[model samples]
Target: MGIIDINKVTYEYIRRDEDGNVEGITTAVNGVSLNVKAGEFIAILGHNGSGKSTLAKHINALLVPEEGSVIVDGMDTADEDKTLSIRQTAGMVFQNPDNQIIGQIVEEDVGFGPENMGVPTKEIWERVEESLRTVGMYEYRKKSPNKLSGGQKQRVSIASVIAMHPKCIVFDEPTAMLDPKGRREVIRAARALNDVENITIILITHYMEEAIYADRIFVMEEGSVVMQGTPETVFSQVDMLKSYRLDVPEVTELAWELKKAGVPIKFPILTREELKEELIRLGKR
Candidate 1:
């Protein structure tokens, strides 16, 4: 079985009136099924309110399924006994670093997860050091999170999650509030975690560029997965994605335009370098 599995999972949000009466229901996740193998880097993409965040919350057990099931590390999220274990197995990082960071000092902040899990004080420090180093934030261990740049603070937030030694990490638009450089830094850290640590990564992002590096991509719309494939395969369906109010990476769009103009450029050109090479080859012809 994959490290994370969603089997026909569905979740609904209940709207309540001020009088505490049940008003309405909105199905946020609709029968979404996916399997994420250990060490895989998966990207979830969609427009705002596409149910990506709701799906992510299921992986971390923040919200249990209203129907069907979500399993993390072979444990069902709906099992109350497994909730803590499920959360530990799949750590979560959110968009706002300011909200995640709790300690005055960077190292302390990183140590909080393991500390809460009843790890020995000495071992908590060890995890804090290792996690910070993993995210390239070890040198800033003594610094205050408030003093760091958005990128740096986000890295610290990632370090805090890593300190829990999770088998998988769910990032819910972690780079949303970051500048371009900050976004790059956070993405780099995520890549490093997947590559060097072999941690399964579930990244929910709106940025098409960020999805390029994923092993697989799942595009959601109206609480269901509308597309699922490798970056090349998914981005190749330009019209479909556009219909869903999503965009392709700039290079992919350029390639699509070139193809439409009868240049014979392939669909889903992911990077500038690849586009340059393709253009060079076409010029040689």
Candidate 2:
């Protein structure tokens, strides 16, 4: 089995009336099934209200599926007995670093997770060092989180999750609130975790540029996965992605427009470097 599996899963949020009667239901996830292999970087893309966040909560067992099942590392998340194990196997990071950080000191915040799990003091410090290093926050171990920049604080939050030694990490819009530099820092850290540490990463983001690094990209709309493929394959369908209310990477869009304008440019140019190379080659013709 994969590190994470969703089998025919569906979730609904029931709206209650003042009298506690069942008023209505909104389906957040509808029969979504996906498998994430060990040590792979996966990205989920969707606009607001597309159930990407709902699916992320399922990975961490924050919400149980109304129908079907979710399994993390072969343990069913719906099983009460495996709840803690599931959480330990898949740590979650939210969009806001302030919400995730608690300890007054940076090292203290990073060490909190392992300490809570009964790790020995010495081992906790070791983990704190390793985790902070993993996220490039080791130098700030003694600094206060309040004094750090938004990107630095987010890295600390990620280090906190890493200290728990989870096999998979679910990052739900971890860069949404940051500036360009902060966003790049968070994304680079996320990629490093997957490439160097071989950790399974599930990144949920609306930014098309962020999805370029993923091994596979899944596009969601109205609680269903409408598209799934490598970044190149998915971004090639510019019109289809536009129909789903999602944007492609800027360079890819430019290439698509060039093709439409009879420039004879091919599809799926993801970066400016790639586009420049292609244009140079075309000019030689």
Candidate 3:
């Protein structure tokens, strides 16, 4: 089986009134099923309230499925005994780095996960060093997290997760709180982890540009996956994605407009480079 197997998982929560009375139930994840092979980069895309975040919670067992099962590395998330193992196997990096970083020093923050897991003192330091270096934060290891920028702190948060040596990392909109440059920094670190370390990455983001780098993209709408395919294939359906209140990469939308205007441009132009080459070819013809 793949490193993550989510089979027809369904999750819902009861909405309670201020008086502690049950109002109604809202189904956040509806019969969603997908698999993530080890060492692959998968992106989950959806606008807010589309259930993307809810689906992500299952990968590491933060939220158990009420109807189906989420099996991570062959262990079912529903099993209470396997919860810790599942968490160790799949680490999580949330949207806000401040919320995740809790140590006085950078290295201390990075080392917290392994230390809490009862790793030897020597190995915790080892992991801290390796993790900081991996994210290009080694030099800043002695500094406090409060002094770092949004991007640097996010990288530190990532370092904290990697120090645990998890097989997969779930980034739930890890770039949502950063500026453009900060967002770039976090994405670069994520790509490096997937390329260099071969760590499986499951990224949940609404940024269309970010999704282009994924091996496969899953588009969610109203608590279910509506589209799943290579980035090119999924982004090619401009109209469909629009209906889901989602946007494609900027270049893709531009190319779509050009195509509509009879420019004969190809569908799903992911990058400016591709669009330039397409225009150059058209000029030559």
Q: Judged by lDDT relative to the true structure, which candidate is superior, 2 or 3?
A: 2
- The residue pairs that clash in candidate 2, if any, are none
User: lDDT of candidate 2 vs native?
Assistant: 0.95
Q: Which stretches of candidate 3 lie over 4 Å from their true place?
A: 18-20
Q: Which digits, one per residue and each the tens of the lDDT, describe model 1 over residues 117-184?
A: 99999999899999999999999999999999999999999999999999999999999999999999
Error of 1 at 101 (Å): 0.3
Model 2 TM-score is 0.98
- Ranked by TM-score, the better of candidates 2 and 3 is 2
The TM-score values for the models, in the order shown, are 0.98, 0.98, 0.98
User: Where in model 2 is the C-alpha error above 4 Å?
Assistant: none
Model 1 misplaced stretches (Cα beyond 4 Å): none
How well is each residue in 1-285 modelled by candidate 2, as lDDT tens digits? Answer: 899999999999999999999999999999999999999999999989999999999998999999999999999988999998899899999999999999999999998889889999999999999999999999999999999999999999999999999999999999999999999999999999999999999999999999999999999999999999999999998889999999999999999989999998877799989999999999999
lDDT (CA) for every model shown?
A: 0.94, 0.95, 0.94
Give each model's clash number: 0, 0, 0
**Residue 11 shift from truth in candidate 1, angstroms:** 1.1
Which pairs clash in the backbone of model 3?
none
C-alpha RMSD of each candidate structure in angstroms: 0.9, 0.8, 1.0
Instruction: Kindly provide the TM-score of model 3 when superposed on the true structure, using C-alpha atoms.
Output: 0.98
Residue 109, candidate 1: how far off, in angstroms? 0.5
